[model samples]
Target: MKHSITMLEKTALAICIFIALIAAAQPELMTEHIQPVVQDILSFLGSGFFLFVNFLLFAVIILSFSPLGGRKIGGEHAKIEYSNFGWFAMLFAAGMGSGLVFWGVAEPALHFMNPPLKQSLYPDRLASSLALTLVNWGAHAWALYAVFGLVLGGLTQYSGNSGDICAPVMSAFGNKLSLRKKRGVVFTIKLIAVFAVFFGVVGTIANSTLLISKGVEIELGITSPLLIGTVIVSVLFVTYTLSAKLGLRRGVQSLSIFNVLLAFSLLIWLLFIVPVAPIMKIALDGTGYYLQLLATGTWQFDSQLNTSTWATHWTYNYYFWWLAWGPFVGVFLANISQGRKVWQFILAVVGIPTCVTIIWFSVFSGAAIEWDKLNQAGILSAIKHDYTQGLFVFFSQLGWQGTILIWSSLLLLLVFVATSADSAILVIRQLVQNQFKNESTLYVWCLALFMCSFALLLQQDEPLNRSIAILGALPFLAVFILQLAGFLKEFVRDLCA
Candidate 1:
């Protein structure tokens, strides 16, 4: 146990390096051969994959209003550590900020043009764009998170133990195990959990750097976008490292609050500046349409308005991506969520973020869809030609080319990335730390994470990164399901008593 974190790092690092080496040596084989294998695996997971996550969300909804929802995650008398606002800021930034920015402008446009579905249900290009986009970003994603965070927080508060993923499982099933057996179980869970978080963050950092590169080119007109991107990520790594060093309350919380405000400022501007009628109309209609088709499992197979290919690429991939991100996001949520009731945590974790995405997609995607309709600035062509630069291009088209708008956006992205990586660093250290006593483990893992992400950015093998990221979630997903089951069992017993 003393050197468990070191051992975990060695194990995870070896696997990551081994995979990277194989992908590096034969990039084509990896892309051509390995990627299809991954796609096949995802296809095998299929509707079951979609259903499992959706069911988790549904389960959370049922529980949130029951007696379970009134139960406090921490002690009944514990004081809240972070304000609801700050807590939400961290959760949103860490959980889905980068995804929102990347997909916000691009997805609606793509769906508008290609209309991923073969059926005519949502075939109206401009009208249903927000609906198509929101389904992915909305309640389903947050539902997974709320459960994980609640369980983690529950174990921590109930037992006066700072719990890891294995805690709930142990609480449920390890009661008969000897001390040695429990340690073994925890050691094993940490090994997989650490790697899953690593892959997810590295993939996100790599993809986010692409967005930063485009932002630099669009905002500052710098020539070497790649180099600029590297610098930007490096700076973010340094910033988050220091933030991690400050611990949760001071470092991560401050950054989260700032980024949420920054991102919201942009959302407000776009929503207000853009015509009110279309944005409101698209959001209202799209929401109803999305809710109506909630059970269709449109992500599973070929449908009238969509193709199986579209589901495989978007919905299936996102399911894994969100799951992969669970540990990083869950740990952060658990840490900051003390003193909150289960229902409040659910509301904070599931409801607020979902609503934010609805508004965000409504404003951003709605505006882009309107522009595509008007062809006022050829918005569709801009996004089609270069999706990474979509947000910048949208800004340019809207005549918000002022440095204040552009530079502030660049800052907003940076801070969001920083808060995410920083919060994950804090959690990863706790996961891999030596019985939760190791300090140097935090710095070592933090730097190692950014370096891995930096190395992947250099490789620029997005498909491989994305494929492995998707795969990383599979093991973790199995573990989380067990944890959820374990949590429910223990809670029921408590309720009965």
Candidate 2:
């Protein structure tokens, strides 16, 4: 099979590399100057972000029950390519990534120590902290992916377009432009997609590896961030690159299944040991708080509670992070979800993984809270010092079993990181090459991604790394709105037909 390249692909690749170059050379510029501007922009757009995501969640639910929901993605006769288990596993692994593991213990503890709500009872604060964590990781985040995936799948399978990021953009307005102008638009959007994905994944890599390096030190007593980061990045690059080479079925699918099982095994073990009553209580109450606040309070940044910037720092940052990942995950989901009905796609994408998230966070955070109540270990203090240490600190309270659990978590975290990087490499190839063809360039691209991530690790400042990630994702806000419009236009056309 011959793989042909175009100027569009070249331009996109060039722009991606240039962004990485900027990050590597002028980290201060991004952190010092660009960070404040980006934060303010995100603040201004906060309400819009909340409202859009809320719309997506409700829209997906309504669409799942409406007449359009009955439509099959690749037509009525197309058969499913992946088993239900495989489908769920891959989508969950690809979308959630290591952030779930990285934040499982830390986020809840952080929120508990400094919760958004100022005036609340002790138990209410606990439940509300977990609820806020859920708000970040739960339905709203997945709904963005759910709706975007539906649109991408409809276009790729039903509208006869290639799996390029620009397909939806082109479909939305391509008819109004000339051939030369259309090519320019396609080139521009693909460039933005590549930039968004590269920076977003780089941030993930920096953060996950920071955690993994600390995990290595905990297990093996290797204290050098440089050595640990180098080894982890090298291993991650090789592993994911090999997986990409093996393609989706043999590589990604198998890894995703194993990841989900491993993660759940950890969750189940925690469930058995943690105070079951508290776990259940937090899960129930947290979920209630999440739903109750879904519309009214999820996006609020209260001034009286000294949380005026809390929403800006955490919630808005997360929204942009999800938006940045939307195109990559959307493309990956649409590709795998070829034969499912609209409602099936919506439910599976938005429902199953979200339930898993709520449960995962509840069990882990509930356990941390229970232990903290006893002062078994300074879990909150550890998290306050370095968010990566929360998982290990919480594990330390488990006695002899702590060793085994921490090691198991280390393995799971590594695989989670690998799966994320692997899928990202595959997606970048598809976007740049305009197809899913495997070639030498895939390896080169993987190495480039590693370079970008490695530069972030070299910075060695968590807050700075996070700011860069947010900055990188900022441009995609406009792109997401464009894609949303394109999707609705296409959906309405299909309804009319």
Candidate 3:
């Protein structure tokens, strides 16, 4: 089977190769020259990005109840490929699995000590911390993914191709724009989205590898072995690649369900063993505060606080990460989510996962905070020294300390990271390919992405990684605005019909 190359794919691959070469050769140059300037620009516009995410949260809500929501995503003849549980599990696994486990405890812990909303009169740091975690991982972030998914939901029925965000944008306005201009613009935007996803996945793998290595070091007698990390990465790449080869229904779905079960077991365990009344109090108070001030709090920007680092690093960085991931997650969800109405797809993609997110943090982070406050175990203090071991520290404090429990959690996390990587590689393969049947395309991206992740693990430069990611994120945020405009125009026209 011969694969044909197009101008868009060729250009994108060339740019990636060029950047990779330079980054591999001169990591210091990027941190010194490029990162500072990009960081400043993103910090300045951080508040606007926050507000934009909030807007998406409500936009999904409003659109759901509108006439457009009554519309169907596919024709009457469309067929459902996966059951609702299977669909939600697979998409949720792809969308958040690894990162959620990493951040579930760490994010709220970090925010409790060093909060972005420092001057706000919110008493009880515990409640505020959980609320902020919910704010970050809540509806707004998922809604961004849904917006992109909704735009491309109909492509499978109409185009018989892998669902890509560019297809929908081009369909909506291709007739009005010149051929050269439309291709150039759409291709450039997609290239950015692709790179964003590539960096996000690579960074995630590198970070998770470190976390797993730390867990191994803490549990056993070994101390910071590179061989262990390398072995783990090799195993991960091979496992996820094989899983991807099994395809979605069998490989991805099976792993997705396993991880969800694993995570729920831990959550349920924590619910029983941890201080139940206090955690419940944290959940209710935090969620109440978040709901009350969702809109205004998101829009507020106080430069007077002199906590630019907090805003830029925490809130701003999260929004960029979420936006960078939006295109891949959105298209991947849309691909599996045929044979459903527009409203059902939107709610499944956006609403349900969000509810799970709140519950997740309530169990993990909420329990961590309570332990730190009452027991004074200094688990929070220890994390400041080595962030990689944050989860292990939380695990030690968990009421169950059996060898089986500890090892099981670690294995669950390993599978979770693999699921995320394979899902991402599949998304990137579909984005760049012309034929959906070609397994070779999937093989190429899967190996290449694993290689890239290894290279990044060697360099270990946060700024360069973040700078490349922000370059993709900032532009895609702009592109997202354009997509919203195009989608609304077409949606209104359909309403009139």
Best by TM-score: 2
By TM-score, the better pick of 1 and 2 is 2
Please list the C-alpha lDDT of all candidates, in the order they appear. Answer: 0.74, 0.80, 0.73
Candidate 2 accuracy as lDDT: 0.80
Per-residue lDDT of 227-262 in model 1, one digit per residue for the tens? 986897789788988999998889988888888888
Query: What is the Cα-based TM-score of model 1?
Result: 0.91
TM per prediction: 0.91, 0.94, 0.91
Tens-digit lDDT string for candidate 2 (1-497): 86666676667667667767887898887667877887788788876787778878988899899987877766565568999999999999988758889888899888888777654422488888888888889999999898778767753333544244666677678479999998787767877777777777878888888888888887788879889999988888898888988889998998999999999898888777767888899999988888877766654535323556677778778888888888788889878888898889988999888899988888888889888887757888888888888899888788878888898888898888788888888887787774446487777788788888887888777666666666656777777777777777766676677
RMSD of each: 2.8, 2.3, 2.8
lDDT of 3 at 221: 65
Which number leads on lDDT?
Answer: 2
Total residue pair clashes for candidate 3: 0
